[model samples]
Target chain A: AQSVTQLDSQVPVFEEAPVELRCNYSSSVSVYLFWYVQYPNQGLQLLLKYLSGSTLVESINGFEAEFNKSQTSFHLRKPSVHISDTAEYFCAVSRPGGYQKVTFGTGTKLQVIP
Target chain B: EAGVAQSPRYKIIEKRQSVAFWCNPISGHATLYWYQQILGQGPKLLIQFQNNGVVDDSQLPKDRFSAERLKGVDSTLKIQPAKLEDSAVYLCASSLVDSGHNEQFFGPGTRLTVL
Candidate 1:
């Protein structure tokens, strides 16, 4: 069984400030990691994912996350944030084998103040 | 391509009443999923279907909640005798079958309020 934990429930940042959302998971087998963003009243949109190859993954919107296997962490980061970046972020993990059910963390709400 | 579609964007029903929600996945996708998202929480998978066959429904509250993906296309979810705790957003997502990368396209969820 796999479970995801997002350490922060809320994070407030001033415009142009850097921010990081911490996420950790527990799994006994290989898994796929993903980050999703949900804007107000909208469905979740994929931000990025880490399947294999590089441990670091990036999104077009200047957001990035690094998958740390040893630490069992997949933290999302952005060097600078804009007011438009305020939204909810979620971390999810899926098992490697068939019947891959993705389990998500209790999201982190990002508030970017102008 | 058109994204997933869901009907009755918002629903309010009294406890012990029944409600149903509909979903249509992206064209040609063979994998569809139903999830429940409570306020301040991430989406939790309720059930999954592969080409109209049940795949996983481990977390679904079987006694009150049921779902089906008929003909490997449109799907419907129902809750009978709803509990107040079941008030949450129900999300539907779809993905291409056998795709190495499980990138799911989601629909704007149906928000259910159990009064």
Candidate 2:
């Protein structure tokens, strides 16, 4: 079994400010990490993923996350946030084997204010 | 390419009532999943299907919750004798195959309110 922990339930930041959402996971085997964003009344959208290599993965929307093995963390970061970036963020993980189930975190709500 | 589709964006029912939700995965997708998202919480996998066969359903409440994928294309989830605690958003997601590291596409979800 695997579990994901999102340290922050909510994070508020002024427009154009940088923000980071912390996530940690526990699993007995190797895993793949991912970040997903959900806007109001919409389904989840993939932000980025860390399958292997580089340890650091980036999304086209200025979001990035680093897979830290020793720390068991995959924290999401954005250098500068906009009002449009306000949404719920989720961290997910899956085991190394093929077709393994993915487990998600409690989620962090990012509120970008003016 | 069309995204995963689910019917009845919202549903309201009384306790002990029965309700059903439908889902259509993306064409050629080999894996489909049903998840429950409680308020202020992350989505929890309720059931998973590879084609028309069950892959994982360890978290599903077999007592009152049932789901099936027919012909390996469309799927349906049903809850009998719903309870107040059953109120949550039911989400359907599809992936190429649970292989490697493919990303799953999600539907808007069916928000079920049990009174």
Candidate 3:
């Protein structure tokens, strides 16, 4: 069984300010990590994912996350945020094999104040 | 290139009532998922189906929650004798395959309000 922990339930940042949403996981085996974003009244969309290759993964929207095995963390970060970036973010984990039984965190609501 | 579709964007029912929600996945997706998202919480997987057969349903409250994907394309989730705690958004998602690296596309979700 795996569990994801998102330390911050809410994050407020001014426009163009940097922000980080912390996430950690506890699993007995190697896992795949993913970040999904949900805008107001919209469904969740995949932001980025860390499968195997390089520890660092990025999304087209200027968001990035690094898979830190030693730290058991996959924190999502963006150097600058726009007002449209206000949304809810969720971190998820799953085993590397076929049956991708994913586990998700409570979620962090990001508020990009203009 | 249609996304996952769910019916009745919002549903209101009383406790102990029965309700059903429908979902139509992407055109060629072979995998479907049902998730429960409570307020302030991330979506939680309740059931996963590979084609018309269930792959995983460990988290589903089988006593009251039942889901089926008869033809493997569309699915329906039913809750009998629903409880107040069942008030939440039910989401439907689909992926081309049931793999660890594949991304899942989600629907807008059906918000169920139990009074």
Candidate 4:
């Protein structure tokens, strides 16, 4: 069984300020990590995922996340945030296999204040 | 390509009343999923389907909730005796494959409000 924990429920930051959303997971086996974002009035979309090869993964947007195996963490980060960057971010985990089920965190609402 | 589609964006009904939501996955996708997202909580997987076949439904509340993917394309979820706690967003998603690395496309969830 795999579970995700996102410590922060909400985060408010000024425009152009750096931000990081913490995410930690518990699993008996190695798992894949993912970051999903949901804009207001929009459906959830996959921002980035960490399958293998690199511990660090980046989205098309400026956001990036690093998968730390030892720490069991996959924290999302952005050097600078824009107004449009304000959205709900979700951290998810799933085990690698034929039948995969993704488990998502409660989510962190990022409010980029201008 | 067209994204997933859901019907009845918002629905409100009294407790004990039945309600249903529909979903149409992206063309050619074989895997479909139903999730329930309560306010202030992340989406929880209710059931999963692979080409009209049931894959996982352990998390679903079998006593009141049921879902089906009849044609390997469209799916429907229903709550026979909806409770107040059932007031949440029902999300439908589909993926190209049933792999951990596959990306699932989500639809604009159907928000159910129980009065």
Candidate 5:
């Protein structure tokens, strides 16, 4: 069985400041990692993903996540954030084999303040 | 390309009552999934389907919950004798394929409040 853990339930950062949302997972086999952002009343949208490339993956919207194999972590980070970046972020993992069920974290609410 | 669609954005019902929700996946999507998300928690997948066939329903509470993607397109989920714990957002997602690179597109979930 695979599981995802998001250490922080909420993170508040000033506008233009850097932020990080921590994510860790446990799986016996190879895995795929993903980050998703959800706005109020909207469905979750894919922010970025890590499959089989370099450990570091980036999103077009200035967000990036590094897949740390030894630490079993895939933390999302952005050098700077905007007020519009405030949203609920979810970290998910899909382990190979089984039903390929993608397990998600509890979520971290990022609040960008002015 | 349009994303996945779910109906009845919100529904409130009394415990022990029955309720049903609907979902329509993106055009040509071959995989669909149903998830239940409780407040302040992650989404728990109840079932997954590939076309009209069941792929995984290990977490589904079959005693009270049932779902079907009859024609391999749109789908519906039903719950009989709902319990208070069933009050949560039911989400629907669809993917182009059931592969390693599968990127499931989610629909705005249907919030169910059982009184």
Candidate 6:
């Protein structure tokens, strides 16, 4: 069994400011990590994923996350944020194989203030 | 091309009532999943299907919940006697296959409110 823990329940960042949403996981076996975003009234969308590759993974929208095996963490970060970046973010963990279900954290609400 | 599709964007019912949600996955997707998203909580997997066969359903409340994916393309989740705690958003997601490289795409979700 795997569980994800999101440190922050909500984050308020000024437009064009930097932000980071912390995520940690507990699992005995190897795992894959993912970040998903959900805008208001929308479904969850893939933001970025960390499989077996470099420690860092990035999304096209200027968001990135680093997989830290030692820390058991995969924190999502962005150098700058736009008003449109306001959304709920989730951190998930999945087994590194086929037909595995991803377990998600409670989620963090990012509020980009102008 | 198209993302996952779910029906009846919203449903309101009383306790002990029966409710069902429909979902149509993306074309050619071989994996489907049903999740429940409670307020202020993350989505929890209720059932997962791999081309009409059950892959994982350990978390599903089988005594009251049932789901099926006929033809492996579309799926339905039903609750025979809904409880107040069942009031949440029901989401459907699909992946080409549950491979390492593939990702799950989600639908808009059906918000169910039990009164």
Summarize candidate 2's per-residue lDDT along B1-115 as a digit string, tens digits.
9999999999999999999999999999999999999998999999999999999999999999999999999999999989999999999999988863789999999999999
- Write the candidate numbers in order of decreasing DockQ: 4, 3, 6, 2, 5, 1
lDDT of 1 by residue, B1-115 (tens): 8999999999999999999999999999999999999988889999999999999898999999999988889999999989999999999999987343589889999999999
Model 2 residue runs over 4 Å out of place are: none
Candidate closer to the true structure by TM-score (higher is better), 3 or 6? 3
Q: Per-residue CA lDDT of candidate 6, range B6-110, in tens?
A: 998999999999999999999999999999999999999999999999999999999999999998889999998999999999999998888644688999999
Per-candidate TM-score, chain A: 0.98, 0.97, 0.98, 0.98, 0.97, 0.98
Kindly list the per-residue Cα lDDT of model 5 for residues B25-103, writing each as its tens digit: 9999999999999999989999999999999999999999999999999999999989999999999999988874578
C-alpha TM-score for every candidate: 0.97, 0.98, 0.99, 0.99, 0.98, 0.98
Candidate 1 structure quality by residue, lDDT tens digits, A20-103: 999999999888999999999899999999999999999999999999999999999999999999999999998766668888
Q: What residue pairs clash in candidate 1, if any at all?
A: none
lDDT winner: 4
User: In candidate 2 chain B, where is summed lDDT lowest over 10 consecutive residues?
Assistant: B95-104
CAPRI quality of model 4: high
How well is each residue in A23-98 modelled by candidate 3, as lDDT tens digits? 9999989899999999888789999999999999999989999999999999999999999899999999988878
lDDT of 4: 0.96
Best by DockQ: 4
DockQ, computed on Cα atoms, for candidate 5: 0.63
Which sections of candidate 1 miss by over 4 Å?
B98-100
For model 4, residues B1-115, the per-residue Cα lDDT tens digits are: 9999999899999999999999999999999999999999999999999999999999999999999999899999999899999999999999999987799899999999999
Worst 10 residues of 6 chain A by lDDT: A95-104
Better of 2 and 4 by lDDT: 4
- lDDT score of residue A107 within candidate 4: 99
Query: How many steric clashes between backbone atoms does each model show?
Result: 0, 0, 0, 0, 0, 0
lDDT (Cα atoms) of all candidates against the true structure = 0.93, 0.94, 0.94, 0.96, 0.94, 0.94
DockQ metric for all predictions: 0.59, 0.72, 0.81, 0.89, 0.63, 0.74
